[model samples]
Target: MEIVVAADASEKGLGAAIMHRFPNGRDKAITHASRAHTSAEKKYSQIEKEALSLIFAVKKFHRMIHGRKFTLLTDHQPLSIFGCKKGVPVHSANRLQRWAIILFTYDLPMQYRSSTNFGCADALSRLIANRQPPTEDAVIASVDAEVRRLFIDALRSLPLTAEKI
Candidate 1:
């Protein structure tokens, strides 16, 4: 038996799948995950987009794949570098380098599977709707606004004193 993870990115979104492959070549999909990219993410280069999909999938399926051996499948051939024995490549973008560090924790080997052979993940990526889930930045911005409001309210209630004590 073997664990197989496949990830793909499209102009619309990112998609990934986790599956179990039996010795006889039979495979069963455990789960399929996908999310629309943020505005900032959509501006990423093609390589970065693909790398982001891999990282997103790895994190989404962390519980099932962590601490276990697995095979990472991607249509992006350049991502195979993540599994190279020499380690992270120096020429990779800063974002990819950071993602590589995160990927290093998982004991998985990367493999390049052509898109035609990677239909499940490929379809999912393109099928994603335009809707986007609430982001951490949104939550943090709300919190910051609330704090600033409270600070202003508190200041308004206090009287200013220039007199020396």
Candidate 2:
């Protein structure tokens, strides 16, 4: 099976995509969104968080396709950092650096995809980041459920062909 992974990072949050090739050879995209550090001074933290989120998405994909060949694509520049020995600029915390090191164990190939090609994941990350917080548990649960449903529905409709990068 062939899979394509995409990720996008903003000051406020991060988003990732796992595009899987089905038995019928059709691509299906699954996505996840998470909040992250937003301050300009702490921009490195934001990038680290985005990288971890991308790693999380890869783990999710691995669960679905164990031992399968896959490619990971990200809009972030300096994709070489994924294979670098020295610390990367965006990795502030040792934990984040360790996470990057651990992800390499999967031996998945990393590809540098342009930002224009990752619009869907970028949009989803923004949408999640913009969500209003509710004071009540019930409201939070409702909102979370709705967001998950919407994400799944959007993934189902994503185009198989790679967007022009």
Candidate 3:
């Protein structure tokens, strides 16, 4: 299974999605996540906002993706420099340098994708967060349910299952 994480950030929020890309080249959304930024985060520069979004996505999906390699897609082109292939920047903000150190631990190769082709994450980032956000357990349960449903759907579509029937 090929895993791709797409992340985006807006002034209001950050959004990300973990996508499973089949060998046949179809992409499936394994899970999606978004959250409103804190007042301080909202004041971050554009690059900082983008970096934060990537960090959020990586940490959110860490369990499924930790030790393994994956591709990271971001609309912000400058982020490509932060991939494992490129060494950490020497002259960045303290906050960014710290984030880069954290990201380096993950085996992800960053790729630049244009905004028009990145609607999923873009829309997510623009969404208004609720006054009362769902509990972490509820969010996990929802993602688990979606993954289960997708697994069952894939199984049903297999020719072996059809033959058994």
Predict model 1's lDDT versus the native: 0.90
lDDT of 1 by residue, 1-165 (tens): 799999999999999999999988866899999989888998999999999999999999999999999999999998888877667778778998999899888999898989878898999999998666768999899999999999989976777744623
Model 1 weakest 10-residue run by lDDT: 156-165
- Stretches of candidate 3 exceeding 4 Å from the true structure: 130-165
lDDT for each residue of candidate 3 in 1-165, tens digit (9 for 90 to 100): 989999999988999999998999777898899999987898899999999999999999999899999999999998887885567678888988888888889988898989998988889999956665678999999999999999999987777865576
Off by over 4 Å in 2: 21-46, 83-93, 129-165
Which lDDT tens digits does candidate 2 get at residues 45-107? 655656765665666556754566666667776555774455455635676667777666665
After best superposition, candidate 2 residue 119: deviation in angstroms?
1.4
In order of TM-score, best first, we have 1, 3, 2
Candidate 3 residue 91 Cα shift, in angstroms, is: 1.6
CA RMSD, predictions in order = 7.3, 15.7, 12.2
Model 1, residue 51: displacement in angstroms?
0.5
Which of candidates 1 and 2 is the stronger one according to TM-score?
1
Per-candidate total of colliding backbone pairs: 0, 0, 0
Question: Which stretches of candidate 1 lie above 4 Å from their native place?
Answer: 132-165
Better of 1 and 3 by TM-score: 1
Deviation in Å, model 2, residue 58 alpha carbon: 2.1
